[model samples]
Target: MQLNKQNLTAFAGKLPCPDYDRGHLQTGIVHIGVGGFHRSHQAYYVHQLLKDGTPEWGITGVGLREGDRAMAEVLQAQDGLYTLVNQRPNGTNSSEIIGSIRDYLLAPDNPDAVIQRMAHPKTKIVSLTITEGGYNLNAATEEFDLTNPDVQYEIAHPQEPRTVFGYLAAALRKRKAGGHPAFTVLSCDNIQHNGNVARRMLLAFARHQDPELAGWIEKEVTFPNSMVDRITPVTTPEVSEYLFREFELEDGWPVVCEPFIQWVVEDNFVNGRPPLETVGVQFVPDVSPYEKMKIRLLNAGHSVLGIPGALHGHPTIDACMRDKVFAGFMRAFMDQEVTPILDPVAGIDLEAYKDQLEARFANPNIRDGVGRICSESSAKLPKFLQPTLRENLRRGGEIHRATFILAAWCYYSDQRHNEKNEPLEILDERAAQLHRAAAGTTTDPISFLRQESIFGDLSEQPRFVEAYTEAVRLVYDRGDVRSLMADW
Candidate 1:
């Protein structure tokens, strides 16, 4: 009774089989950054379409690096088969072996193959899940850095390129030459107006390399904004074991995620797309409001909690949330700090949204990484914290809490005092400067707080600068994250 693809068809009581042949499903989408989240989220939706006899939207996944090649190898050996395990605190559910990924492209192995596929008349959508840092962008300008060695290599040799922007620009050039209709470049990353960010980088890269191609892209491409959400972690043996025992399949690359999922997409397509609305994908006129809500609220909330929680020696989000102090910190950060400035989406209840966030954070089964949230703090801070800080400062509201959060970040990045006594693995571009600014044990700690890139022009404002200075001083001297503020 082992649940291989054959027996897994009806594994879910609610999930039914397609009336047609899933193997006949052909590739219509070329997905970039085919990692765990893309596999668990977008691929899961496509698999649902397959189960309902929609075969036109199968994916040809493209991996940008050697690590991706290993993932591709696993899926290819399993015959493009994998399982998705969805769990909640109370129970679990599983998907049959997914076959929606028709093929994978290793950029180094066959860049031509990927280029040809992207240039294909039938490939309607090009989706991306490359993390924020992968954009290789200038943190201040939000533009691609042509000076980056990867970008320089991609520029010099257009063929057999490695960067996402390079591959995308090359593929679009092919389509433009082929007289093929342009594809929609849907961004599935968590960045704000990610479609715009992707467009800015790609077009900027193209303009630097070839101005004509940039013009063609402006005329032909549809970079639609999207907001995607899910909580899927890196796959581990415990997850593989869960899939094997529950589904009775030995999937080499299984994706386990929380039960919650959301995708709000712009209703524009060039070559055509799946009936994904039938599978709960919301096609909307705009995704900005939704994007802001998720980014400022959900993602910012995670960033707010992640460092403090990690420094306190909490292993997972749930474990951190279980501590009364952490829970209260989340509430105050959301209610007192983040919510006041947020304009609620049309149907969203701010209170209920807060409640759901708390519930999601408390889901013990979903072990989201502290490090994952901590990466690219230089890029992330402006988007996540600076906005709220500006709004609060404009109103002369107290931002002591937000300031303390920044102090925590500086300390964490400083790494001189991690409980393990190991140095912090800071990944920021401004690390050396920030380290020098923070040098010497002093009670008047605005030296580090004066980082203009992170604090922005707002650091010039006397009130905001004073508050940040005092907050850093208090936290460093007290040596207790909670004691930095007596209220919480």
Candidate 2:
């Protein structure tokens, strides 16, 4: 079946399909960033709600960047319908035609069209999955960087806004003037306290653009913190070909993910929300414990596990999990270095959670890109490792494994090439600067850790500095990633 609205009925019997009248779906969620993660997780959840007769929660997805045009076109052609393929390690696969997305608009094509969608009276929620860096925070200060070129341009030209925050502030202004209640701003990014980050940045942007609107937002809006998890790999052509060859499905952009999925949300939406709990979403009084646990444990654990594979030319995360040395080191490292600092999270067994992470990483059917974990190490290392580092330093915990990860990152940045001698695509804002610093300073690890943005003052501390220097020298000595776990 060529998966589009017309072919939907013919394909419905082949897979679990939306049972509701697709025409009856109302657009309530104006989601910004219709990426793989959002489609496989949030949109999938909304699809379940619609199937169970939940009203007015169908998503009107918005794409903000020029790169999103391709996705926008695909969703438009398919009538906001696509397939989600779950590939499990247990030798089982499942496919479903998801129809929760009611519409999509490319904001770069027409900014006002998206602003108007956000201002719509029926829109009760405006969500985002615009990645961690998209928040535009000053890495050190954690405040909205008003001086960013795009931020400056958007502030100057409010009507033709370029940034997400600019569009949001403008939309709220319009909605308030029209006597409409503010929509809940839900952030699905993997940022720590993502809701708080969104609220802070949006309010800051609005205060600079219009102080009155900022006040209105501070008094009227609700930004709920959430913890969302799913191992959705980036979409590739091979995925589509596999779907067609296996089941005669021709989905232009089918999202492929692991079978595991979870969402823990704070029940604090200003405008009413759908009964998400009906579909297994855990609505909690506080999401901090869950958020911290996941970010430090699973999210941070990704880099801890996958980066070594990346350095060694391993194609996928499963390869890293299958490697006996890498897998063993991670199991011991987490037990010793990562888990001790965590405060008790409600209803979570840390030991069992660690076990599940190992199992999830070993899911060979889910070919999650090693590059995905290694992609933004510059930004991610600070976010993921600093908490553990700081706590370990404070409480006299061992940081040997943590420091090795740092050295591994520094090594990867310098040796940003694979076994084939092709340049590895490094996706980081500080890539050139880090490489230049590390050009010949492998023995003197201080040159790399002197990057105050990444390492802060930890480079000056004797224990961490010694550990980092030893690890870097040992690994760089042999130029082998497997040497990371060796006693340096």
Candidate 3:
């Protein structure tokens, strides 16, 4: 049977389906960027709330880019219903049909409709999962980039907004003029202080358009920082095919993920918020310590294995974790390098959390792609790994493994193929610059480290330079990542 409202009751005995009335659901949230992460994480949470009888918190997902058109079509065709499959480490699967997404709007097709939806009084929250780079932050200055052509276009033509910031400014301005309360802007991205970052970027864009409107948003709006965690991989055709073969269900866009899911949100919504805390969501007074611990450990751990794993021909994170050498290296990096820099996260056992991370990475069924983890390294490394590296360097702590990871990244950037002759896909935004700098590592050993925007004077540090240069030589000259990791 096809996955939709009509076929909901048909799958009742086969798997978990929404037990509530779908027609009574109302849209209280307008989420921008309806990607796999949003579907599996935030949408899933709202689905749980609906299942528990809170029908006022349905989601209206918005897609700003043309790439989101496919998702729009799939969700609309399925009546905004899709299966959420949780693949367990023990090779078992638990699937549920999430029904919190009541509608989807492709913003590129109808930007006015999206702005109007956000401007509506019922949209108490406008959330985002627009990745790390979507905030339009400058890597060097750590501020909103007004020089971007898209941003400039939005600034010039505010009525027909293009970027997320443009859409937000337009919507919030309408809300203010119409005598409606401004909604909370919740950011569910992986960045530390994600809400603060969102607020700063949106206010910057709004101020550029109109100073008075920016002042209203500054005083009236609240952006709640949230830390969301889930191992949702990019959807492959195999996922839908698996659903068809096993459960006799046809879902054009089903989400598949590991059984682990977490969302730590700050309890600071301005408009009336949903009872999300009752549905396994942790409402915290402060989210800093939690975000710091998660980013430095889990996010950094992915990079710890990603570059070397890709170079060594490991196809997935689980593949790298299966190898004793790779596993030991990652463990050592976490315990010796990252753990010391972390503050005491309230109510969380650090050692147990590390163990859980290892288990999560080793889940064979998840098949988390190494290339996916390695993609956008230029953006990811600055937030996830570089902070740990800087802290270790300042405190005279263990920097060998972290430095070697950077060397592996440079080696990976310079190479065309892994050890197994599989093509190494360079997916970073600064791929060209990375390749150019890495190519000069043979003659000038510190070329890659000289990227001031990324490394920030780390090339001048003799200790870091010595370790990174030796690591580059070991990996590039010998072409033996396994031996280098094993010896380290």
Candidate 4:
């Protein structure tokens, strides 16, 4: 049987949304980067909102990339319907037919359709999950790369666009021209101060196009900070088949994640907003503290463990968690390198927080890929890993562990040496630079850190450079992460 909109009805028996009222659901939100994470995390949350009440927050997913046509086709056939399975080690808890996604627009295939939706006055929130690298930024300069041909073309032809920032800026220009107030630009990426980054990119695009329009957005728009956490893994063939058999039907984009989910958002919206607070979303004065702990601890933890585990022949996060040495290394690294710098947010217990992370990683049913977490390391490290490194060094703390992290990062980016001694695939913007750097020993850690764009001004720190250099030599010479880590 072909999986389509109606096939979702088969799942109703397994997980019910009896109270869900689709008629009341309004298209109030527009989401960019409607990938697996958004479907599993943000889309699931909004689905809960509709299932309980407040159907006014349904999402219209926008695929920013040209090649995202397959996703568009799948969602369109299903009427934006999909399943969300919360997997635990013991069992599974599934949601039947998440109907929060009302529509989808593949921007390359249907640019006009996307623009029309963006221009709608009813759409009050423009949220994003364009990933760390999708922002089309020069990580070193912390600015939009207008030099990017995609961005340049969008700038040249404002009537049509390609990049996320371009599409957003063009839509805002339409809204401004029509005398419609700008909707809030809510960023849900893993980066720190993501809202500010989004605003900066958008403003940069706008200023280049029209100075007055940039000022207008600065006055009318609100970019609210948010902290979103959920362990959503990429769907595998085995997992997908399991879900299909378990549900008694097919689901093309089922989101399998850990049972735990959280969203801490600032209450800032233009036109209107969702009653997300009703659905357990914490509406706080500031999401900064929560953001800090999540980015520094959980996100950084993933990056820290990613390459080490991958090279150690562990394919899944759970497998890595079960490794006694790796597990302790993570805990100790967090305790020594990351945690002290975290100012407790809203009485959050630092010790208990660490305990929860252990449990989250140990969820056996959730098969998070090291490669997935490991993607875009160059972009992710600046936000997720660099802060902790800087804080520890500033206080004259041990950086040997953090330096090993950088070395592992260098090795991973080099993307070589599978267990079979074959080449591991590299997927990043700076593959060539990394490949060149990886050929010889990165004995001088400063050489890697000196990439001012990624490390910012931190490369100039004498102590940090020393620690990084020492760690690099240790890893290169020893050629064993576990042994080097154990000694540390």
Estimate, for each residue in 1-488, the C-alpha lDDT of model 1 and write its tens digit.
34334654555453433345756877789998888899889988888888787677889999888778788787666656677777787755655456788778888788888888988888989999988777776655555777888888888888757888888888888888888889989888888788888888888889887899999888788788889888887677988787556555566777878888999988877667788899999999988888888887788888778777656666678876887788788788888988877775877888998899899988887877676666667778777777778789999775767777887877776654555554555666666776776764274466665666456576577887787777666667665675443354
Please give the CA lDDT of all the candidate structures. 0.77, 0.86, 0.91, 0.79
Candidate 2: minimum summed lDDT over ten consecutive residues — where? 479-488
lDDT of 3 by residue, 271-293 (tens): 99999889899999999999999
Ranking by lDDT: 3, 2, 4, 1
TM-score of each: 0.90, 0.96, 0.97, 0.95
Candidates 3 and 4, the one with greater TM-score: 3
Tell me the spans in candidate 2 whose CA falls farther than 4 Å from its real position. 419-422, 440-444, 486-488
Ranking by TM-score: 3, 2, 4, 1
For model 4, how does the per-residue alpha-carbon lDDT over 333-352 read when each residue is reduced to its tens digit? 89988877877689688899
In candidate 1, which residue pairs clash?
Answer: none
lDDT for 229 in candidate 4 is: 94
Highest TM-score, which number?
3
| Runs in model 4 lying further than 4 Å from the true structure | 1-3, 17-24, 91-95, 419-422, 442-446
For all candidates, the clash counts are: 0, 0, 0, 2
Whole-structure CA lDDT of model 4 = 0.79
Best of the candidates, lDDT: 3
